[model samples]
Target: MAPPLTPADLTPALLRGALEAERTERGGLLPHRLPAWARAQNTDGQLTMAESQPSGVRLAFRTRATVVELDTLPTKRAYVGVPPRPDGVYDLVVDGRLLAQGSVPGGHVVTVDMTKGTFAHTPGAPGTLRFDGLDGTVKDVEIWLPHNETTELVGLRADAPVEPLPDGGRPVWLHHGSSISHGSDAASPTAIWPALAASAAGVELLNLGFGGGALLDPFTARTLRDTPADLVSVKIGINLVNLDLMRLRAFGPAVHGFLDTIREGHPETPLLVVSPILCPIHERTPGPGAPDFSSLADGQLKFAALGDPAERAYGKLTLEVIREELARVVAQRAAGDPRLHLLDGRELYGAADYAELPLPDELHPDAAAHRRIGERFAERVFGPGGAFADR
Candidate 1:
C-alpha cells in the first residue's frame, strides 16, 4: 500500500523537491516540452514556434473581493515558459499582491510566491489554490504574463476540504470570436468580454477566442463540432478584414461552412451567429499589405498597416455587411432549423458604446467596453427566460 502524505510532504517545499528530482532525471512539466506542432493544433497555432511555444493551459480563480477567513492554503506552484517579449519583465501576483516581478529566462519555469497554509490536491492536478487562517471568503485571484507569450499552471494545493463550484447546471455556452472575445488589452482575465458575458449570464463558457487568430479554419470548426455544449455562438467577419485572410466571395461561404460544421455536433442547440460591431477605421479600409514586422522590429513603425485600398472597400468587413450576411444566413438556416438563433454583435458592443469607451486600437475593446458588452449580452441573449436562462 502507498504511504500517506504527511504535512511536510505537501508544502511548497515539496514543489522544490519535485523540481529537483525532475531535473536529475531530465524531466520537467509535461506541457513545457510539448512540441510546437502539437500546441499549434489550438486556435493560436500560427504563433507557435519551437523556441516560443505555450507551456499549457492554466486555470485561475478570482473573487469580487478578498475574504478574511483562512481555512485553506495554496499548495501548488504553477509556472509557464514564454518567449521574450518587447517588454522585458513579467508580472506575477497572488490575491492582487505583486509576488514576483522579473525578466523571464529563456524556456524556464517562473514560480509565484504563495501564502503559507495547508492544502489538499483534488481530482484535478495541482487542484484549486485555497487559503487557510482567514475569516472571510476570497473572491478574485489573478496572474498576468507578458503579451505574445505562453504560460501554464503546473501545481495546486489547498489545506482544508475544498469543493470547486459545481459546473452551473445550465448547458455550457461555447463562443468563438476575434481579439475582442480573447480578452485583448483587458485589465484582467475576468475583465474579458466573454468572461464577463458568461459570468453575467451565469453560464459555463468555453471561449475559443484567439487574437488575430480567428481566421475561419477547418480545424477550428472541427474543434467546435467535437466539443459538447448546450448553446453556441460564433462572432465572425472582423478577423477576416483585419487579417486580410479572405475576400467577399470566400467570406460568405466560409461563414456558412463554419456554421455547418458546428451543426454536426449541436444540431438542435440554440446557435447564435454574430457579426462584428462598428469600427470606422476598418469599415471602409482595405488591406493587402503584409504585416510590417520589419519596421516594427526596428521600432520604425508602431503598428501594421492595411495596404490594399481596393480590397479594403470590396473585401473589407463592415458591420453593415456582416449584419446583412448574418441575417441572410440565419434566415436560410431558420427555414430548416428552428433551434438556431441569430444576434447582431452590435447589440453586445456597438459604435455608441465606442463613443463612451473607445477601443484602444481600431480592433479590440477596452475594459469598460468588456463590462458593457457583458451587461448587454446578459440582457439580450441570456436575459430572463432567454435561450441561456432557466426555463
Candidate 2:
C-alpha cells in the first residue's frame, strides 16, 4: 500500500502578486505589498495597516493534490459599537477559474474607536482552510488572499507534491490608486476591478491600491518608479482631494515630481494617468471628507465632504478641479512624452453611472459598480487603439 503524503514545504517563491515576503518571527510568511525600505519611510498607522493587507497577493502552484489545506493568521478590523465585520475570504482558483471560496475563523482583531480615534488589538488562535475534490490532474492552482485583511501564511499541506507555477510570460500591469482600486466592497479578491480588468485583458496585475494611503507620497512614487512593469498606470486625484492633503500650488508641482520620478525608471513605457470617477459628494464640494456620524449611529457607514463648494475659488480641491488638473498635466506632459496618456475618470463612471448605480457609501463603489468599471476599463484601456493597447 502507498504511504500517505505530507505537507509541502513552503517558501516565498510560492507567492505571486506581492512585492515582498517577510519571514514572521512566529515562523509564518507575511506578504507585504511594499518593500521594507518604502514602508520604513512612513509613520502613518493607516498607511502601515493598508499596505500590509495583501489585496492582490496569492499562492500559485502546480499540483495534482486532490485535497489542499492552508493554515493562516488573519488580522481582522472592527469598530467600537459597530457590528463585527465579516470574516475574510479565501478564493481557490483552479487553472485560471475561480472554483471555490473559504474563510479562516480566528486569528486577531484590531478594534478601532472612530469617535475617539483609538484602536486596540486582541490576539486569537489561527485557523485552517481546506479545499476538497480538486481534480487529480496536475494543473495550476491559486489561493487568493483576503483583500481587506492582513494575513500571515502559516503552513500548506496537500496530498501530492507541489511546485511553483511556471511564469506564463504575460505582460505585467502595475496599477496604483485609492481604496476603490483596493477592492473596496468587491465580493472577493478576484472580483476587484483591476483583477477583473487584468483577467479580461490577459495580463498579470500588481495592484498598489492602499485604502486612505493613495495621497501620492514620494516613497510610493519611488516604489512605482523602481518596480518592474511592462505596462504602468496611476489613478490619481480622489484620495488627494478627499484627504485635502494639499492646495493647488502644491498639487501641480507634486504631480509633476511624481511623474518625473516614475519617468526616471520608465522613460518610454506607455503610462496612463487616470483621474477620479464621479463622486457626487465631492463633485463640486471640496473635501477633508468626514464620516457621517449620524449614519454610523444608526449602524450604517456613510461619508460626507465637509469642505464648502465655494472653496474651489481658494484652490481647495473638488473632484471637478482635480479632473481638470489631471487633464492639463497629461496634456502638457504628452506634448513632450508621446507615450504619456490620460483617461478622464468620468469616462469610466460618470453622472449617468451615478444615476444608475450610485455609490452606496457616497464614496466607494459597490460590487456591481466594480464590475461595470472593470469591464469598461478592459474595453477602453486594453482594447485595440486604447492607450495601453498592444500595438
Candidate 3:
C-alpha cells in the first residue's frame, strides 16, 4: 500500500458540482456552492450557511485502489433544546452505483437557539473516513459529501494514484429550490430528489438548492445565468411565503426579473419554473412560518404557519397565490420564450401522496416523499415527450 497523500494532493480538478473550493486557514478545502463573486454579495447568514453545505458536491476520480481514506472536518448544526441531528453521511459510489455509506466520527458542532436567534460554536477535530475492499479493476469513484453539513476536505489517501474522471458528455441539469431540493430530510446526499431525478434521466447534476435561501435573489439568478447547463429549473414560492419576504406586488416583478437574468445566458435552454409543493400549512394561509415550539418540547422539531389566511386579501403571498402568479408569469412569457415551461410542484406531491407519505415536519418531505418526488419529476420533465426531452 502507498503512503497516504497530503492535503495538496486533492486538487480542484477532482471535485464535481461545487462552484468553488476555497482554501481554509487550516489548510483544508471548503467547498462553496456559489462562486466567490456571488458569495461576496451574500448578507443573510442563512443563505451563506446553506450554500456552504455542499448539497450535491462530490469528489470524482478514477482509480484501481482497493482501499481509500479521507479526512474531513464537518460542522453539524444542533438546536439548543432539540435532539441533536445525526452525523452527516458520506456516500461512496463506484462506477455510478452506490456502494457504501458512512459518517465521520468527530466534528465541530454549532448549537442554535431558534427562540433567541443565537448560536454557539464548539470546535472539534477532524476525523478520517475509510472504505476498503473495492473491485481491483480501474473504475470511476465518487465520494458524495454530506448534504446537510458544512464539510472541509482535509486529505485523501488511496493505494493507487487518482485522476479526475473525464466528462462523460452528459447533459447538465441545473436545479435550484429550497430545503426539499437541498436534501433536508433525505437519507443521503445521492438520495436527494434532484440527484435521484438526474440519475434516473442520465443527466449530470449541478444543484443550487439552498435551504431557506431560494427567495429569488438576484445573485442566485446571476449564478444560474453564468453557469453552463443543458437544462435549468427553479423551484420558487415556498421560501418567499415562509419568510414573508415580499407581497404580491413585488413577487411578480421578482419572478420576471429572475427569469430574465437566466435567459440572458440560456435563452434557448429548456427552463422549467416550478411552483411550491402542497404545503398544507401555507397552502391557503400567508406565512412567515414559525416553528412549532411545542414539538421541540416533545423532542421533535416541527413548523407551523403563523399568518392568517385572510391576509391574502391584502396581497400577502400564500402557496395558492404564488402558484397562480407563477403559472400566469410562465404563460405570459411562453409566447416569446417557447423553451420556457412551468410545472406545478403539487403534481410531484399532492393531496393524495401527502395522505400516504406526509411531511414529517409539516414543511419538508421525508425520504420516501423525496424518492416519490424524484421519480415523478423524472417522468414529467425528463421522460419522453417531457419538457426537457430530446428534440
Candidate 4:
C-alpha cells in the first residue's frame, strides 16, 4: 500500500460515470457502478460480477501533469486448463484521442480451475503505472480502466494540478450487450466498439456490456430505465443463443419486457435494437458453448458450438434466427413506437468482414473487427438520417 491521495490533493473534483460509491479500503477509494440499492437486489455472483467491472467507466479530468501515476488493483481471471489470459489494458486519452496504452503487471487473480470444479484466489503485490515526458502541457486526460476486468482505484497522482472535466454537452449514449460489447478481446478499453463509436461520435457513453450476462433481466432494464440518456441501444441475441440461456419461446417476450422497462424511463428517447454480429459458428446452431480443450491443451483455447443444428426444430435461437426475429419484433413494436429502430448486426460486422477478420476464438471478435464495427456504427447511427441523427 502507498500514501493516499485525497480529494483536497487534486483540484476541482473527480468525475465517475455510472459509479455510485467511493468505497473506502486501505485508505483509498474504490469506485462502484451499482448503486447501494441495486447491489442489494443482486447478491448473486453473476449480477455482482457483471455490474462491478465498470465496462465503460473512466477517470476523466483536466490536468497539466508532465508525469502521472495510477494505482489499481485489477482482478484477473484464468481458467484451469488453459493458457493465461492477457493482462488488462489501461487506455489513456487526451482531448478525445488515445495518447497511450499500457497494461499493469501485478494484481490479484481469481482462478476458475474448472478441471477440478473449483476456484482459487491468489493475492499479489500492487503494480504502479507511470506515464511521463508529456511536454508539460495542460490538457484533459481520461484513464479508461480495463472493461473486461474488475479494477479498484487505489490512488491517482500527477506532477501538476488535476480536476474533473464536464461532459461538454455531448449526448450520452447508453449501450448494453454481451461479451463482444463487454470488450472480451479488445486491444484496450477505449478500443471497444461502443467506446470507439462514442469517441468518434463525440458522445458520453454508459456501457452495460456483460459477459454471459445480458439476459434481458429486469434489473438491467431497471438500471437503464432509471439512468438518464439521450440515446439507448441493446445488442441482442448472441449471448442468449450461445449460452442457450433461453429458447425462442421466451426470447421475444423477454426482449419486449426489457424494452418496455427502459421505455418507462425514457419514453421518447431514440432506442435501437441491434441483432448479433456475424458469428458463423452460431448463425444456424444452438449452443451450450463448449470450450475446445484440444486447443487449450496446446496452449490456446477456443469455443465450438455443441448443440446440433437440427435442434432449431426445437426453437433454438441461432444468430440468423435471432436477427430475423428481432427485425420482426422491432417492426411490430415500432408501429406506434416510431422512436424505436433495428440494426442488422451484420451491418456492423457481416460475413464479408468475418472472412477477413474472423473471430479468433470462434466467438469474440478480434481487435480489428472491433475497429471495423466501431467505424460502421459511428457512420450509421450517429451519422445523418440514422436513428441518432442528432447525436
Candidate 5:
C-alpha cells in the first residue's frame, strides 16, 4: 500500500483520487438525473426554466471532491408555490465532471450521499455550510429539478472550494411582479424577461415574480422589504384581473397595504409601481379564468370570474382601472415620499406589441415577445443615463 494521504499533498490530481477512494469505500455513488421538466424558483416566489422539458438535458456537475451539498432558500415561504411534479431525479456535476446525482422526492429538503462529508438540504433553512480539507475552488456547480413545479432558491451553499462572485459593481435591480414578470413561458432560466432585462441593462437582478401566484399579498411585500436592492419595482394588476379575484372595494386597499409594507423597509429607496400591460382578451375581460375552457373550469371552482363584461371592464377592476388607481396611490404617497415612482406596464409591453407579438395563450408572452419586452424595459427603465443606467 502507498503512504497515507495528507492535506498538503492533496493536489487536484490527488483530490480526484481521494474522491474515487471515498466512493470505493462507500460502495460507490449513484447518478441522479432531473426529470425533463426541471425549473428553478426565483426570489419573487416564481418558477422559471430550470431545465428543458422535451430536450431532457440532464443537470449535472463535476468537481474533484469528497462530497457535495445543495441548498435553495427563498426569503418568502408563503408565496413560494410547491412544485407541480414534485418527484424527480437530479444529477450533480463539478468542473465538467459527473460526480453524484439523486431524486429530491417532493420535499422542501433532500440530500445525496457522497461519504465522509456532511451534506444538508435546507430550503428556508438558516446557517451556511462550511468546507473542510478541500483545495482549489469548485469551478462549476449545477442542479437539476422539475421545471413544471414551483421551486424557489433562497440560498445556495457548497462545502467544496468556491469563490463568490463580486456584486459586479452594478446597481441591483430588484423587481416584483406576476407570472409574466416571473418569465412565463420563457425559453430558459437565463432567458426570462427580468433576467434578460437585467443583462441588457448590465445590472444584477433579484426577480420576485410568482406565477399564477402574484396576488398582492402582505407577506410578499414583507419579503421585498427585507431584500437588499438599489432600484425596486412592483408590477401589479394583471394577475388580479386574470383571476377575477377581487372587487374594486378590496382592490384599492390591497394596493395600499402592499405598498405600505414595502415602504416600511425601503423608506427612501427609488421605488416604482407598475400597473398591468395590455391583453385585449383580458383587457376588458374579467377572469376567474382565461378564455380557454380548462382555465374557466379552474376559475369556476375558485370563483375567479366576474360574469358581467361591464363589471369586468369597469366595476370590478380592469387594467385601465388599475393604472388609474396606481397613479393616484403613488401621487398621494409621493407628496410625503419623494422616492416613490410609477410606470405603466404598457411602457414595457403593450397593445401595439399585440399587433406584432400577439400573446399566444392570451395570457403569457412567447419567447420572442419576452425578448421584445426586455428590450423595451431596458430602453425605458434604464434608458440613456437613467437611474438604472451605468453612471
Candidate 6:
C-alpha cells in the first residue's frame, strides 16, 4: 500500500527542459518554451498559442515519494461547433516506465468556433493529479504535462524529497516544425514523434515545434541561432503551404535567411532541412487549409485544402512544389555547405505508408501514425549513416 498523504510541503526543483518558467503573481508558475526576449518580438496569436502549448516540455526529478500530488490550471482548447476535443493528456513515468496517466479537466478553456472562424477564452478551475502506490524506494520520476495545453502549475507536493535529473552528457537535438511536430493527436506528451525519436537516438531534445506557428519567422531563426545546440533541424514547408504565406520567389530567400541566421551560431552543426510529409489534400492542390466538418454530422472531423490547383500558376505553393524546391535548395547549397542536407518528409510518411496508416484528421497524424513516423525517423535520422551521424 502507498503511504498516506502528509500535511507537509513537497518541493521538486522544477526542471524546465527547453522552457522558461515565469512565476505568476497568483502563486502559480507558467511555463513558456520561448524565452521572454524572443516573445517580445511579436504579438502574433499563433506564436503565443504554440509556444504556450509546451508540446515537448515536462518536469523531471528523482524522488522517493510513494504518493505524488500536483495542482495545475490547464488551458484546454475546444471547438464550439464540434464535439469537445479530448482533455490534454498528462503522463506519470517512474523509473522510465509509464506508471499512470490522467487528464485534467479544470484550468482555462479556449474555444474555437471553426464554423464562424472565431475564438473565445475562459478561466478554468484548479485541478489536482494524484499518483500513489509507487515502490517508495528512491527512483526517478517524470511528469509529462499536456502537450496541447497551456498549463499554469499551481503547486507540486509529494511524500518525499525531489531533485533534478543529473545530466549524463547526452547529445542535444534541436528541432523546429509545425503542428504535426507539436504533437497533434498524440496519445501523450512524450509519445510525440520527436520525443519518441529523441529517446531512440539517445539525444536530449529541444523541440521548437509550434502548432500553426512555423512560418519561418526571422525571430525564430534568431532564437535557433542564439541557442546552444549540437544538432539542428528545420521542418519547413507545411505551415507555409497551409497559411499561403509566401510565393516561390520569396520562399527561397526566406529559407536561405533562416538557415543563414542559424549558421551564425554553429557553423559546422549537422543541419537537416525537412520538407512536409504527404498530405493528400494538399498534394496537388494549394491551400489555405480549412476544417472539413463534412463528417462532423457523422461524428467525425477533418481538414481540407481550399486553394485551387491552378493557383500554382500564380506562384501558389503545394506539397509537391515545396518538396521539389526544398530538394533543389539543399542540393545547390550543399556544394558550399557540406554540413547541410535535406530529408523529404514524404520519405518519413509517404503515399504507400499512408495507404496503410492514413492521417486521421487528413492533416495531423493520429497516435498510431505518430508511432510509425517516430520509428521511421529514429531509423532514418539517428541510425548509422543518417543525417545526424556523428562526425
Candidate with top lDDT is: 3
TM-scores for all candidates: the values are 0.65, 0.98, 0.98, 0.93, 0.61, 0.95
Candidate 6 off by > 4 Å: 1-13
Model 5, clash count?
A: 34
lDDT of 1: 0.52
For candidate 5, what is the lDDT?
A: 0.55
Q: Write the per-residue lDDT of candidate 3 for residues 134-239, one digit (tens) a residue.
A: 8779999999999999999999988787889999999999999999899999999999999999999999999999999999999999999999999999999999
Per-residue error at 88 for model 3, in Å?
0.7
Candidate 5 C-alpha lDDT tens digits along 73-163: 2121111121232233344444434445454333344332222233445453322222324334545543433222333222333333433
Model 4 quality (TM-score): 0.93
> How many residue pairs clash per model?
27, 0, 0, 0, 34, 1
lDDT of 4 at 183: 82
Tens digits of per-residue lDDT for model 1, 1-391? 3222122121222211011111212222322222233245754433332112221122234332222111111122231221222322233345435444333333332242122322233322112232333323643333332322443223333332222223336557777777677666565545567766776766666666666656777777877787777888888877776666776677788888988998998888788877787665565564432334444345332233464455445656545556777788889988998777787777777778878887655566776887888778878888875655542
- Full-model lDDT for every candidate: 0.52, 0.91, 0.93, 0.82, 0.55, 0.84
Ranked by lDDT, top first: 3, 2, 6, 4, 5, 1
Give a tens-digit lDDT track for model 4, residues 1-391: 3233332242114644554645655655555666677678775675577677867888888877777888878888888878788898888888777888888887889898655667788997677777766656778888888887777777788767677786688788989898889888888888889998988888898888887777787878898899999999999988888788888888889889999999999999999999999998898888878777777677777888988999999998888888888988999999999999999999999888988998999999999999999999999999998889875
Candidate 1 runs further than 4 Å off: 1-149, 161-168, 288-309, 312-319, 385-391
Give the runs in model 5 whose Cα sits over 4 Å from its true position. 1-161, 294-306, 312-314, 385-391
Deviation in Å, model 6, residue 12 alpha carbon: 9.8
Query: Candidate 2: lDDT over CA atoms?
Result: 0.91
TM-score of 5: 0.61
lDDT for predicted candidate 3 compared with the true structure = 0.93
